[model samples]
Target: MSEREVLELLRENARYGTDDIARITGLDEDDVEATIAALEEAGVVRGYQAVVDWDELEDERVRAVVELNVTLDRETGYADIASRLARFPEVTALRLVSGDYDFDMEVEGDSIREVSRFVSEKVAPVPEITQTVTHYVMTAYKENGIEFGDGDEDDRLSYSP
Candidate 1:
């Protein structure tokens, strides 16, 4: 199997061992192991993480998407600003985008107040940041291509007035 196939299989299920991947992809177990090791060494595969449903847990957590409009510096531009934003522990994802906003940031905290504080005290205070609009996530039906709750509904109850 091609390297792309191996990568795809791993992406679908990170827990797949060399033997399992080799068996499924029709590649030798040694080759599969070597390919994975090479991918890791070359930085093609960065890291593995489990997708957790934080909402289901007892701990209270809040997630917010903050859109930022910024004045880009002539010398370094958005990279410098984006790198600075990425250093914050609360920031899960950060991207420089086109159109209305210059940057999009995803932040998580223990509470709504904590998220608000991050925007006010940390993000908003940056010199390059001109404007910010924060939107808090209410309910997550799907995340990272995985459906959060039960499968699609099949039947609906009807009532006559």
Candidate 2:
């Protein structure tokens, strides 16, 4: 099997062993192992992760997407401010976006108040940050290409004729 095929199989299921991948792809087990090692070394395969349904857990959490408009530094631009924002524990994801906002960030906290506090107290105080808009996530139907709940059921009630 080609390297691309091996990568595809690994992407579908990161836990697949070398023997399992070799059997499916019709390649030798050692070849599969070597290809995976090469991919990891090259930084193509960053790390394996389990997608957890955080909503189902006993402790409730709040997630919010924050849009930030910032004054860019003449020398470093958004990179300096973005790197500083990334260091916050509450920030799960940060991206330099193209549009009305300079940066889009995903953050999680114990409650709405906590998320608001982070934005107001922490993010707002940054010298470069001019404005921020926070949108809290209410429900997650799907995440990371995986469905969260029953696939067959519709959210709306069936109508009676």
Candidate 3:
């Protein structure tokens, strides 16, 4: 298959195995593997990720993003502050960015109060975290652009673009 065909396959679903891609594209398994490897090396295929349905989980968990305004102390390193927060399983993703907030944290908890406690007891106490402004997600309109696909009954079941 052509490079365009390979890219379309990869874009549709990066998680597809080489054998599956070979089946779809009519290319040999080794060729498919080489193409995928080349794309990854070129940074086109960055990484693989799982999309979980949080609502289906047994625990009642609420997702939230906490914007932290921090003052990195000379004594405490940024990694050290991040390490402290990471100890709690609730904190999911942490990133330091340039903006009003020093760190953006994605976390989950059973309730608002539980999240509050996590922020107060677990997060705020960290040496660098001087302030935190939280915004709780009331509802997610859509996640990852997966909007139930087209409602049209006639659409083919081919892989997504």
TM-score of each: 0.89, 0.84, 0.66
For model 1, how does the per-residue alpha-carbon lDDT over 1-161 read when each residue is reduced to its tens digit?
46888899888889999899999989999999999988899999999888777779999889999999998767768889999999999999999888899899999999999999999999999999999999999888777667888777867667646
- Residue 153 shift from truth in candidate 1, angstroms: 10
**How would you encode candidate 3's per-residue C-alpha lDDT over 3-99 as one tens digit per residue?**
6788787666767888888898899999888887888899987776766565556866688899988777678777887777877899988888887
Q: Give the TM-score of candidate 2.
A: 0.84
Model 3: lDDT to the true structure? 0.79
- Cα RMSD of all models vs. native, in order, equals 6.2, 5.9, 5.5
Off by over 4 Å in 2: 152-161
Clashing pairs in 2: none
Alpha carbon deviation, residue 119, candidate 1 (Å): 1.1
User: Residue 141 of model 3: what lDDT?
Assistant: 50
Error of 2 at 59 (Å): 1.2
Better of 2 and 3 by lDDT: 2
What is the RMSD of candidate 3?
Answer: 5.5
Name the best candidate (by TM-score).
1
